[model samples]
Target: MKTTSQSRMRMVPTITNETIIALIGLYCLAVVMGYGRFLFTATLPDIMTQLTLSTTVAGWLASVNYIGYFIGALIAMFVPQRTTWQTLMLWTAMSVITTMMLAIPSLPIMLWYLVRLLAGIASGIAMILSSTLVIQSFSLERRALLSTLHYAGIGVGISASAILTWWLLSLDYHFDVIWLIAGLSSLPLLWLLLGIRPDNAADANPQPRSIHQTYINFKRSLYEAISGNGKAISLLSTSYVLAGFGYITSTTFLPVMATNQLADTYAGLQIWLVVGVSIIIFNPVWGILAKRIGEINTLIGLTLLQALGMFSPLWFAGALGLYANAIIVGMTFAGMVSMTLNIIKNMNPVYSNLLIGLATLAYALGQFIGPLVTVALAGDNDNFDAGLLAAGIGLLMGLGLLLWFRQLPQKSV
Candidate 1:
């Protein structure tokens, strides 16, 4: 009886290797991209009080972070092949260091900019490296599902920040303490992600190349990525820029908007929490939907949904509208990102990193531009109506780009 039972147990599938790698990737992203990169926005209101910052200054700081992100992506595109593990480790450490640096009370605004900027660079590199390695660990058939699970980390990080900030603030923790807590929370994730390696077949048996050869290879990949799929990449880049502008403007100001409304002291928290929850729930839904309906069609629908969500709060003007806006915008932003990257990956599997890096660069540019313009338009009155309208229009422009992508020939890429 014992032998028979053991045999049955052996037949069952336990946690697979791929599952472990995916979890590590997800955790790394949540820590680095979610906590390290975005926790700033979650805690911005509190930090603003401590720093005595103006809206315009705060917006410019945010833009500085995006600029850092763009530079990081540009660097990642040239990262010599087969060094994914080293890249991940270095950037993950930078993430931890930068997050903790923000915990310093009474720091100069310039220091804050530098810290956040470094965090953004860490996040950009970590994002592409983890995505590339984790996706490589899974089979082609299972890639989409695992990729969605990986992207869900962003939402998970956002939700975690919201809950933690709410609880800590309720307990009367100061801004410095909250930043320290967030930094401390990321420590364990580093150890957890230590085992995830790039198992890419192409990278498995890497041959050492001279510096010149490496430079040549990098140039070749960049040229191939652009020349091979110029039209598709061009369209994707424009869409990414619009998406970044639309989403960042909404997210950056939502908490401030909620506070100005004076609806409830915790109203902003609740709304941000809802946005995070919706993102977590919808990532997989859109992933599966893309599988069924095709990525192109899914992108078109989600972009339109996002545009509506961007403008909904201004149009409806109530708690109900705010919640609807949160759900729609949060749900669609990540889906649009996932679908867009998937399409880019499909366009040229070999140049996936180059393409994704380019897309991220475009995204960073949009994020950089959005806040500067929004803050300028929204001087002391806390009025973001004009900014929100512009965000919505940006999404509509993105929708037009997606339509254009669809109209191209089958060999467009």
Candidate 2:
């Protein structure tokens, strides 16, 4: 017979443990993604002004970062054993250091490019590790909800940085000051990592695979994914590539585009703030909707919404279009990411993490291509309308693929 005191103590530790895990995952994303990844967008205009960057060169910088992201994803897929929470901590710390390095006023353009590229790699690893470990912490009954909380960290980080950027800019702070502040703010998250017990998760199954077995398994999965009913899954994976291209174009350039169109430096940051808010608010809702309507259908609907979001700036003018773009795109993108991962996991539970890394690799490749196309089309005018149009078309093509996928026999994926 258990006393009430013992029961209370047990309950308290369990709840405390759960909360701590969620917080670690959330702040890891906030530091790695919000600061490391999207911070470039918030600071790009300033970097361009200070460095005298041409549109073409800016595109190159973005591409190089995504290239690092691709390499990180590849490593995560092939060598998942390295993705411990300690590794996540190491990468998160590196992101802070590299982000601050960009504040060096005398840093060459090439150095800026290199630092951002390294930051991207750290961000990519942190993103994969945080999502993987956080999801594994919850049981199947609670996994979807917990997954929503985990990914929502990206939005939280984005919103916090956007607000901070806006506030600092209003006070006439230099971009370097902004970077320093961002770096310092991440220091507290490090303490949370101290409490992380990777083996404490309810579902922590560290399956060790030899390199030879991993290679053979990879080959077998690849062959199956490309043949027979697996063809639908293959096609689905391909759609993620286009999704990456479509989303990254707007994400990379939204602030620059907004500033130019509105003739207000802060307008873009404000819109980005809206986007962050929408992502935080809607991701959990999207998770619920996925459970209700089915992941495939939810993905199709979200993709269609995102396509329209990409085209909104081109379709309408003034604040109406900008806000619509932020809200629609913000609400859909993170949800689509979560749903796609869920679909992939359901398709292959045994190899889900590797498959996710594979899907992310495809997406990273598309991201690598996106900025080059945008810059190429923008030329000297700096007008991004044509680039945005191309992104919309790419998303529509992905939507078409999803429609075709829907018609296929639902037996496999």
Candidate 3:
């Protein structure tokens, strides 16, 4: 209804309302995904009993989500150019909500598997796309603050789920209720987000990369990360895979690992909560440091620290050792989740999501394989010293990849 010049003037952000709304939407999606994910993990024993499942079957069922995640990220290329970030977020919220409502103890195993995989894929695309939007929406100076807060969503969601689980489990309530509650909570968030759309994606009309190009870039990145193809292509891909294994081992297996090291009866939810709280506190600190020193150096130093934290408790068993390991490992590890995308953004401004999708595939593979491998390594003792050691190797591999990336020409990354 307005003149063209007037419409142009209105497009300028005077109060930054749109960006703030988009970030809120991001935080909301994190809550849904984080809660859904941890609730299942923390309540696995009960789920196994109710569903009459074996360990391998359960693992496959759980990991199906990661498979869906990879497929969804890969398919992002086919999404229409007119796709709005809001639409993706809305779909994610809806998928989680519906899946939870329909999820039941008597549901068929294959059906359960399908839902989990689809949910994982939806959540993966939503998370990655939300992150890209957050980065592009803000100025450089405000980025650290926004990024730290955005990353904190997982921690916050985990914390919320932890508290809810504590109350529910203490009262002997079923986990299905928790799932229903998680899904319901997200509905309002989506409703609140109905009017918001990302301005960042509005200006950028990047052509989607072909699947072939994705593989080529990923192969090149992987080759460089591992073989040091001497292009200094950002970190080696194999090493990144290993490091991802190490990081996931810490988050996914650390509670069980702690039980072994210290011989204490720790609840998985409680352990996850402590880890999440620690991450919430430290992510901002890391972001500030990254802003000052640089994301690359911060990544290098943190990876080393993460490696040490992985095996520390096993090396010196005690309450203090376990607690220290939890704080340190949780504090440093998710940077992998956040940083890889940031690094890809730095490396190829053009093919950022494709690179992110490729990197996420490596990460998903690491997570899928890492926990199972750790379980195998634990063997008779159910002691994860062997797993911890393997994690160290993975961390070293990831560090090597990061270092290799840094040495490459700035243009290469």
Best TM-score among the predictions, by candidate number: 1
Ranking by TM-score: 1, 2, 3
In angstroms, give how far residue 390 of model 2 lies from its true place.
0.7
TM-scores, each model vs. reference: 0.91, 0.88, 0.81
lDDT of 3 by residue, 144-254 (tens): 667777777777776676666667767787667767776766665554444345445345455679879867866665444434233443354455677667866656555
Please give the range of 10 consecutive residues that has the lowest summed lDDT in model 2.
Answer: 7-16
Local error of candidate 1 at 283, Å?
Answer: 0.6
Q: How does model 1 score by TM-score?
A: 0.91
Tell me the whole-model lDDT of each prediction, alpha carbons only: 0.79, 0.79, 0.64
Q: Any residue pairs clashing in model 3, and if so which?
A: 225-235, 225-236, 226-236, 235-401, 236-401, 347-413
Q: Which stretches of model 3 miss by more than 4 angstroms?
A: 1-15, 22-26, 49-52, 77-81, 84-87, 98-103, 199-237, 256-266, 318-321
Please give the clash total of every predicted structure, in order.
Answer: 0, 0, 6
Across 154-218, the per-residue lDDT of candidate 2 in tens digits comes to 88888987888899889988678888898988887766665554433323345888889989977
Q: Which stretches of candidate 1 lie over 4 Å from their true place?
A: 1-16, 198-215
**Regions of candidate 2 where Cα sits further than 4 Å from its true position:** 1-16, 81-83, 200-229
